[model samples]
Target: MWQKLYEELQDQNFMIIAVAMDSRGIEAVRGPITKAKTTYTSLIDCDHVVSDLYNMVNVPQAVWINEEGRIVRPTEVSGAALSLNLKKMRKTREIYCNAIRDWVTNGEDSPHVYSDSEARAHLPSYTPDIALAHANFHLGQYLWNAGNRTEGESFMRKATDLNPNSWNFFRQMKNLGNRLGSGGPEYMARVRKRSKLGNEYYPLPDMAGMENLKK
Candidate 1:
């Protein structure tokens, strides 16, 4: 989805940097990325550095950074994805892509672009718990990558406890998922627990036109 949009606007000096926030890195994302054949810059964050930087808790979140290195739009729920072919999701993709095109064409003058103050207002700052959660997540990633699975799992559990609201933390902690495969027993159990609390893993913000996102 992003690739098609990028091609439409790339000639106008637009670029999209899609980052996958997963501890498993390339092994987790190889399938969708390979099948998409995306042309835009795509990278994997083995330690979720990008997620920490943006304080993004959900998958498919995005921020708009302009040529001058300004964040014209701070992080928020994004509709862009590889195939995102669900009917509701396709509508979301279209809405977000159209907004991106408008922003690229009009630059700072676009209504789709947030003003500096508005952008700053949307900027997510870390609280004590979130900060501590990220710290634990990083430790877990380091330990896991260093062949210390036992200790890594311990710290990953801590991170999950510290910030139960972060899907990035939960999903990434669960072996970064198989992408196309079923999430096994433990993962299913956790998802059921989270659902009981009325929070979808990919909870959409209360955007006017996206009421169907919960579906």
Candidate 2:
């Protein structure tokens, strides 16, 4: 989806820059990138700096920046262009794609484009605990990179404890083989629990009143 979008809009003065928030480094994303045949600029964030900067709590989020170096949209779950594997989210994908097209053509005039205050309002508020969680997560990444897996897992576990709602931190830790203990819940289990409760992994964007907007 990104490839198609980039191809369509590259000549239109629009670009998509993807940042991978993987603690395992570039090797973890090399195979997927190669398989996808992507040509757009992609960067690896081994320390999740991009995630921290954007307050991203999960994977597959997006932020829209206009030509003047201003944010028109804050980071939000952008499963539409990225969740092709999930057949159930086809409608969402369509909505997201249409919005992108509208924005590309209309620029700031697009209804989806929010003002600075609106964009800031859409962002998740950062609490002191969340800040500490991010710090622990970064330290955990540093320790893991230094070949100290045990200590790394300890810091990561503390991070999860600090910010239980941050799926990004939890998922990254689990992917790095950091199980809390014998009785600790696994990633799949937590995901399933959320699913059963109708908690959307990617919350649907509120497209209310957007139907009348030009597309």
Residue 166 of model 2 has an lDDT of 79
Per-residue accuracy of model 2 over 45-73 as CA lDDT, tens digit each: 99988888888888788988999988888
Query: Candidate 1's residue-wise lDDT over 41-115, tens digit each?
Result: 999888888888889887789888999998988888786432335777677777777778889999989876887
Best of the candidates, TM-score: 2
Name model 2 segments beyond 4 Å from true: 81-87, 178-185, 192-199, 208-215
What lDDT score belongs to each candidate, Candidate 1 first? 0.78, 0.79
| Per-structure clash totals for the candidates | 0, 0
Instruction: Report model 2's TM-score to 2 decimal places.
Output: 0.86
Q: Give the TM-score of candidate 1.
A: 0.83
